[model samples]
Target: MKADPQAQRRLLDLQAIDTALAQLAHRRRTLPEHAELDTLARELSALEDERVRAQVAVDDLDRDIARLERDIDQVRARKDKDQDRLTAGSGPARELEALQHELASLTRRQTELEDAELELMEQRETAQAALDQVTGRIDSTRQRRAEVEQTRERTLAEIASEEQFKTSARAPLANDLPADLVALYDKIRENSGGLAAALLRAGRCGGCRLELSATERGRIKAADPAEVVRCEDCRRIMVRTAESGL
Candidate 1:
């Protein structure tokens, strides 16, 4: 491509901006906050599962307690009826003996019911403790997530503003350059991780920081102004200017 020297330099500026933008994008993706948020999300999910299980345990214990209470009531009623019959003294020996046996069975059933109720109470207490812990963990995780989100939002906003500034800086170059040159620059940028062009500073390719030979520097200095030159070491478009000090 045969572009004016100044126009080609402007392309180099555009390339610099693109490089910065790419670096910023990479930083955003690899930020520590991103990984922290992911970790917190996993913990939150686990806490929610524990909370659900605790709730189910509590509900099951409640049902068990209720059933035990009903059983105790039925046993007490039977015992009361048999005691009344024994006190009436209108029954034979066999009948009285049967009443005594019924009373013993009822007493044993009541004892068993009371034991089950105590066991359920203990289980309920344990479940409540677990639920509290799980709830606390959830709240903690949510707070951390909110903090991470705020940081992410601030970082994203900063990156956007920086990108906007770069675009503004690049606007002046776009009008003077041809479409084909710009397309090539964009293509190189994509493949080079946004470092499409680099200055030949101090006889070295600034992008790769590789020093050039005496012959290579002389050749580049003697090249026609309209010719596009790439560095032999890094294959980046070489911009030779006063900044290059070559």
Candidate 2:
């Protein structure tokens, strides 16, 4: 392919811009915040599960404590009623003796119920502590996630702005070039990892960093100024300058 000598030189500028754009895209994809968010998401999910389990345990203990309190209250009420009847002394001796025995039994039952209630209250306290700890961890994880997301958004915005600038600069330069030359560059770039041209400096193929053999140098030296030369090794356009040592 043939392109004006100056137009070919401009290809280098276009390549630099394109390379910068590619680097920006890579940075965007591999931002540290992205990985951090993923890790935090997993941690938050696990913490949420733990919080659910803790809350369920706390709720179950609450129900048990409430039930025990009701039982203790009923037992105390029965004991009170029995004491009141005995104090009245309105029944026969046999009946009064039975009432006294029944009051003793009711007292024992009340004590047992109160003891059980106390144990349940302790368990509820422990369960509540566990739930609080889990909830605290959840809040912390969510806060971290929000911070990371903010950082990620800021980084993306910066990348996008830089990309826009590079893109704007590239359009006019690319548009001014010969259509065939730009088409060729695009094709090579697509296949060569975004590198379509390189300077031939110090008798070396800049794209591959390989020295040109004597015969290859001689051929390129004989070629016309407007001729597009591709490196034998890397197949990229070799843009020659005074420093090329051709």
Candidate 3:
């Protein structure tokens, strides 16, 4: 394919910009924030599960404590009502003796209920403390996740901005080249790992980093300036310049 020598040199600039873009893409994939965010996400999921479970436990304990308190209150109410009846003295001696005996049993029952209520209250407190811990961890982890996500977003935006600039810069250079040549370059870039052209510097293919043979160098030296040349080893467009020693 025929291309002006100056236009051919611009292929190197295109290659440079493309290389920068590729590097930026790779950088986006390998950002430390990505891994950190992944880790944070996993941690947040586990913490959320734990927080939910702990909250359920705390709720269960609260219900138990409430039930125990109600039972103790009922027992106290029964005892109080019996004491009122005893004070009224509305019964004979035999009935009064029976009432006194029943009052003693009610007092014991109230003590037992109070003991059970205390145990439930202690359990509720413990469960509530555990729930608080899990909730705190969840909050902190969510905050960290947000921060890492923000950092990842900023990094991606920076890379995207640079890529846009390079793409815009490449537009006119690509437009100046022959359409067929640009098409060939694009195809080669796809097939050759994003490299369609390389500098033939100091009797070498910069793409493959392989030295040119003396006969190959002489052939390229004598070739027409407008004739497109390719690296023999890698088949990349070999662009000549003052530094190319061609």
Ranked by TM-score, the better of candidates 1 and 3 is: 3
| Tens-digit lDDT track of model 3 for 151-235 | 8899899999998998998899888878888898899999999999998899999989999999999999999988899988899
The order of the candidates by TM-score, greatest first, is 2, 3, 1
Worst 10-residue stretch by lDDT in candidate 1? Answer: 1-10
- Segments in model 1 whose C-alpha atoms lie over 4 Å from true places: 178-180, 243-246
> What TM-score, computed on C-alpha atoms, does each candidate reach?
0.86, 0.96, 0.91
Sorted by lDDT (best first), the order is 2, 3, 1
Model 2: per-residue Cα lDDT over 49-97, one tens digit each: 9999999998888888888888888888887888888999998999999
Residue-level lDDT for 49 in candidate 1: 90
Candidate lDDT (C-alpha), each: 0.82, 0.93, 0.88
Task: Compute the lDDT of residue 205 as modeled in candidate 3.
Answer: 93
Candidate 2 segments exceeding 4 Å error = none
Superposed Cα deviation of residue 100, candidate 3 (Å): 2.3
Question: What would the TM-score be for candidate 1 when compared with the true structure?
Answer: 0.86
Which has the better TM-score: candidate 2, or candidate 3? 2
